[model samples]
Target: MIQLTVNGKPRKADVDPDTPLLWALRDSLLLTGTKYSCGSGLCGACTVHVDGQPVRSCITPVSAVAGKKVTTIEAVDGSRVGKAVQEAWRKLDVVQCGYCQSGQIMSAVGLLSKNRRPSDADIDAAMAGNLCRCATYVRIRAAIHEAAKALA
Candidate 1:
């Protein structure tokens, strides 16, 4: 049994240690908000917070995060930064196709949690790994700025 804290709750997953954290989250723990795309971790669809840092769950082994805290999109709104980012995302209509928004939101929250104010360059650098098929980069950047303002 692999033990970890997810969304502030203690949980156990009866899976192989090498199993990707994404499967453990989606299959074992039933937290399906974290998406699976480009399983090689090239895309940010599987982004989640492990110890307050965003990580690609699709390529991360469950064992790698053992005994650590793993936060997913489902619980992101619980944080102040997350709530601000999500509110900005909604207000700015940042969702294009919605498939990548969860990851995008996760990454945005990650960026804002550490840096209260991020310039366009900082936003681009931080969000470089996340891909949006609909090309909503403008709105995403706007939402990040809005969220930063709200946070301030």
Candidate 2:
């Protein structure tokens, strides 16, 4: 059994040691907010916070996170920064097709948690890995800046 804390709740899962955290989350734990776009970890769709640092869950094994804290988009609104990010996303209307918005928001929240006032370059660098086929980069950047202001 692999032990871990997900969205602030302690849990255990009986699965292969090599099972990707994404599967453990989506299948075992039933937390599907974390997407599975690029299984190789190239895309940021599977981003989740492991001990408050954004990590690609698709490439992370369940055994690797034993006894660690895992935070998903489901619990993001529980924090001030996350709520601000969600509000900013809504006010800015940053979603187009919305397939990748969760991941985008996850990345945005991760960036804002560390840097409250991120510059254009900072936002770009932080969000570079999260691809939005709808091409909503402008709105995403604006929402990140807006969330930073709200958190300030």
Candidate 3:
């Protein structure tokens, strides 16, 4: 059994140690907000916060995060920074297709949690791995800036 804290809840997944965390989350834990795209971690669709840092769940082994805290989009609004990011995303209409928004928001929250004031270059670098096929980069950047301001 692999044990971990998920969204503030203690949970256990009875899976192989090498099983990807995405499957453990989506299949065992039933938290599907962390998406699966480009399963090799090239894309950030599977982004989730492990120990307060963003990680790609699709390529991460469940055992790798053992005994650590894993936060997903489902519980994002529970935090001050997360709430601000979500609000900014809503106010700015950052969702285009909506498939990748959860991961995008996860990455944004991760970025804002550490750096309260991120410039365009910082935002780009932080969000470089996350891909939005719909190309909503403008709104995403705007929402990040707005969230930073809100959290200030």
List the candidates' TM-scores in order: 0.99, 0.97, 0.98
What is the per-residue lDDT of model 3 for residues 42-152, given as tens digits with 9 covering 90 to 100? 878999999999999999999999999999999999999999999999999989798888889999999999999999999999999899999999999999999999999
Index of the highest-TM-score prediction: 1
Instruction: Assess candidate 3 and give its TM-score to the true structure.
Output: 0.98
Q: Clashes in candidate 2: how many?
A: 0
Name the lDDT of candidate 2: 0.92
Residues 48-128 of candidate 1 have per-residue lDDT tens digits of: 999999999999999999999999999999999999999999999889789988899999999999999999999999999
In terms of lDDT, the best-performing candidate is: 1
RMSD of each: 0.5, 0.8, 0.6
Q: What shift in Å separates residue 148 of candidate 3 from its native position after superposition?
A: 0.7
For model 1 the local lDDT of residue 72 reads 100
Query: Which portions of model 1 miss their true places by more than 4 Å?
Result: none
